[model samples]
Target: MNEEDLSVLDTVDILDSPLDAIELSEPDSATSPPDPEEMLLLLEHPESTQRIVAARAFCELKDERAIPHLINLLQDVCPLTRVSAAYALGRNPSPVALAPLISLLQQDWNGYVRKGVVWALGNSQDTLALKPLIKALKTDISAVRLWSASSIVQIAQLEYESVVSAIPPLIEALRRDAIAPVRSNCAWAVGQLCRELPLNVVYATAIDALIEALAEDQDLGVKEDAKLALLRVGDPRGLKMIEELEQEGWI
Candidate 1:
């Protein structure tokens, strides 16, 4: 339609109905198109709401085109926005997203942001993330440590031998971490790793942890994970321990 004819229809429609009644369709190209300039501007917006919304919009756009702007947003003063930016970058998982995420994993003050970095690292599946992820597994926050453990699992899934090299640390983590989830993940990753490594490397330590978890952990799921890990690792001695616990009426 001609602009004048469209204008006439717009005027008539406005006259006939309230603005809320007019179904204004969003521009088709506006849905997920990259807008680096707008994203950059939003990064400096005084309102966290605008900054977070813009960061989320950029993520939903899935534009490698916005990598630079998104990277800059990784340091946003608002923890919420920084986390949103981290997540957006993670979802993109471009090479451009890698350096910034690694940097964030090292230095970001928020555990949530670091968790996002863990996810980004897993998405990239870069072996370079191994040491950093291992270090992050020691983070005080349960959420951060959980992702770090999962990233280790992801790496294990790819480089089974290299992951076996991670076994001592994983065993130590299960041996020591205070968090139930971290210990639980440590148990699970060890079970998966045992399938790939010489069973001797993981069998004793993992079986001990799983047996303890099955018997002593307060969370039933954690106990169940321990049971399952024992099954996967398949130690006859571990089963004997469970039977001993049952005989003692400890189960």
Candidate 2:
């Protein structure tokens, strides 16, 4: 529903209306957003567009009563509807929605829908999300991987055991993913998880990966994110390496 989700125009262009039929209008100063109760009714509208609008409205309104309706829209034939429902579920983040979201993430052919589903799972913060999200980070498209990295960090908040399990894949992706945004996200995830990890082999390994990225990554954005990770963790070893690299004008 934010900048990350599909734009309002992109979602509304479901049927590919002719350009001539489109018109821009000025906002009425007194007009208000649709009533939540009315919008909820549109969740079951026969027209896919209305369903999409209603589902998207919940991303901002976030009524829990919309939960089952949003879940039902996950199976709608329209991908836009499905994806919008996915984003709405992310905003609501009802526990019951997680399983259905995971199923859609696993089987939906549309990348956008999968992306929204992963975002929703992250919001769930359930340990159940860890494995599927890790798989998505490793194997899904870059956009999904980017969000998966972020979602992994969100779930990392809940448990130490899960943090231990989550760090390795994040480190792996940090060093290997071709996409800079994904790498940057993994760097941020690694830093956040390291903040919670007790001193251990896994913590050292994550710090090492961040330092390695700072020294060797081809992209400046990835390197900056890694540098920020190192700075945030404040590990003396990482700090010393950063200082030496700065003195040598390598940072």
Q: Which one wins on TM-score? A: 2
Query: Candidate 2: which stretches are off by over 4 Å?
Result: 1-33
Single out the weakest 10-residue window by summed lDDT for candidate 2.
Answer: 15-24
Residues 1-251, candidate 1, lDDT per residue (tens digit)? 23233233222122221211111223366465547678667756788898887777655555666677778788787767777777677666777777778888888765556666776687677777777888877653566666677778777667766675667777777767766667778878877776675556355665666677788777666666777777776778777876787799766
Backbone clash count, each prediction separately: 0, 0
Per-prediction TM-score = 0.70, 0.87
Off by over 4 Å in 1: 1-48, 58-61, 198-221, 233-248
Question: What is the lDDT, from 0 to 100, of the residue 225 in candidate 2?
Answer: 94
Per-residue CA lDDT of candidate 2, range 56-156, in tens?
Answer: 77776768999999999999999888988888888788889989999999998777778788888998878899899999999887777888998999987
Worst 10 residues of 1 by lDDT: 15-24
In model 2, what lDDT does residue 247 have?
Answer: 100
